[model samples]
Target: MIEEPPTTTQRSAEVERRRAGELARPLTRPAGPIAVYDTVTDGMTGWQFLRTGRWLAYTAAAILFAIICLFLANWQFDRGQQASADNAVVAANFSAEPVPIELALPTLGSYDASQNWQRVSVTGVYLANEELVVRNRSNSGTNGFEVVTPLQLSDGSVFLVDRGWVQPSPTDALNPDSIPRPTSGTVSVVVQLRPSEAPLGTGSTTGNQIQSITLPRIQQTTGGDLYTGAYGLLNSQAPAAEAGLTNTQTSMPVEDVGTHISYMVQWLFFALLGFFALGLAARKVHRELNSDDPEERERASARMRKRARKPFTDEELEDEEIDGFLPLTRWGLSSGTGTGSVAGKTVGPTAAPRVVSPAAPRMALKQDDDAGDREQGD
Candidate 1:
């Protein structure tokens, strides 16, 4: 007697069991321990790039870059805030009442920014021979030099006075045609107090030409107890009118917050972009190392090999492409040998066996040309 085929219910139960078995399997393979190889000796391998150590390196580099960006952003923000504060101070004190020269100058130590731009008056004799010209100072877009003269006070102290600006001689930068001489004898001069200049790099000094106006530098050239800060001549009383000098205009520093803000924003953006790029790289490597599907894993590996500019190993070379789908083996009704069809038929002793050949290389599927032609003709 022929045995009855499986009922619908039984087939449904079997399909469910098969599905559950598949689901029970791991979705991805486990990544084994990292392998160490000498990049200089053996060169980098596919395994080295997919290894855990490389991922760790990627993560570390990304974090370091982000940290540096954050530091730069904070630094720019601080500079912007400082600039704003300095601009505010200049606006408030530019036109304030003048103070006594003694009150503005420090008696012994350094003076702070609070004394900057305070108009003051000093009565002293101009040490004309000791006057030094500050190089590279400009006025009204004209290249010039600042004439810094030493003022001898009655109490036996000397102060450096930034008398005014003068045009450099056409022949020499050091020798100017003439610098306005402060009136001879003890004369009272009204001036604006400014903080002492920070000393700069050492350079060759001839006669009175100097790079900057710091107290220590001036003392090295002309020994005396000079004021810690210098004065900008707002008005000067002289014995005789001097030629070839121009009064200097002291403009306040500009408040530029927008440029710093833009820099801060750009740095933060770079950090975020770097982090995202690292994440993408990690994911791609992870897929290459761990995907459970054989085809998908192989594809991922091929991509990595291409990206790293590495050739395939001997074992990994394949002439035939991977087939996406497996052939249908058999139906439950019969063995179905020799391409025989068992449409709604019960399996019995007379049932035929079907033999399937090994799968061939994958090729692009196309419709029959004859069938297409017939359709077109119709």
Candidate 2:
């Protein structure tokens, strides 16, 4: 047996078939960095539209954050303005003329600024027997006890007078013959005004530890008039040698804004940082959005095609057309002259299965002649 090699037409046909198959495959261009970056300048095109959508979402969120930050900044600004106003009020009141002791007493309510200032005057007489010396009183830089005395005023109204600064705790305490006390009938005194219940800025408090001369608290304990707000200093530090009464010292000034200014600064800083960061993030998203990533759309198309059950390859479509055993050449299916089915597998259409017998085929010409002769004889 001689094996025959493929002829020129057969070889050309195979080449053409291969070319057609290759042509049926879709062409795709790979992305380059320059091409990806070029999208940034193109505004919107192809995959750029998808990036634009994402950018829109980022912009919306950025705007929202910006609005929140601006609102917080404005709040801080308003707080700062309020603090400035409060400081101004304190300064103005202190600069105003000193009210007289008599008039100021009755007019304390008329001027609410008295609460913020510590030194206003009051008309009262010093008590000789009951001047109490308070410990740990500090003023300016000096440390002493606040000398407190119940003053019986000329009008019979009693006032707790805080006479300014006395010497710190005395050295000797073992065997004392006599302690100092004050002897006074009617003498003018000067004092610093302070809250009856002032906050201890620092230090630990012992349980039931006695705190020294506080006016409003003393008023609560002693049950006296709440109207009198000023305190006076005594001339002597010790209890009068004759009366054995000691002078008391107290120092209070109320013109501090405390930590409110610092709080306002912190709030403003947060607001600024928020808005700045939001803007930066938005800009980044806007830039990156123009880069390509159309994988979502490709996936969507594939899903649609899967639902429709469309053929993705030309050979598969051609095979379906030849399912009725049509001749391969007529239907553009490859004839199995170069390929053949083995067992039950169908290769090409050259060895197509059929039920009709070719050896005992009926002759169309004989049948037509027999019909014509019978008709003529009749």
Using lDDT as the measure, the top candidate is: 1
Question: Candidate 2 regions off by >4 Å?
Answer: 1-97, 107-111, 132-144, 166-183, 190-216, 224-266, 292-378
Local accuracy by lDDT, each model: 0.59, 0.44
Q: Which residue pairs in candidate 1 collide?
A: 183-238, 183-239, 336-353, 336-354, 337-353, 337-354
Candidate 1, which ten residues in sequence have the lowest lDDT sum? 357-366
What lDDT tens digits, residue by residue, belong to model 2 across residues 136-213? Answer: 665557564555667776766666665444454356321222334544555544433333445343544332222554
Clashes of each: 6, 27
Per-residue CA lDDT of candidate 1, range 1-378, in tens?
Answer: 555755657544544332122112222323222223445324433445535565677778999999999999999999889877777776766677666666776584556676656677777898888888888787888777888888888888887777788887888866665666666876777777677679765878677788887777677657667675564555545444365566675565567889998999999999999989987875555454444445654454344334323333333223212431122122222122211112332222222121111222112111122444588789
TM-score, per-candidate, Cα-based? 0.58, 0.44
TM-score of 2: 0.44
Off by over 4 Å in 1: 1-51, 140-142, 233-243, 283-378
Return the top candidate by TM-score: 1
Question: Alpha-carbon error at 250 in model 2, in Å?
Answer: 12
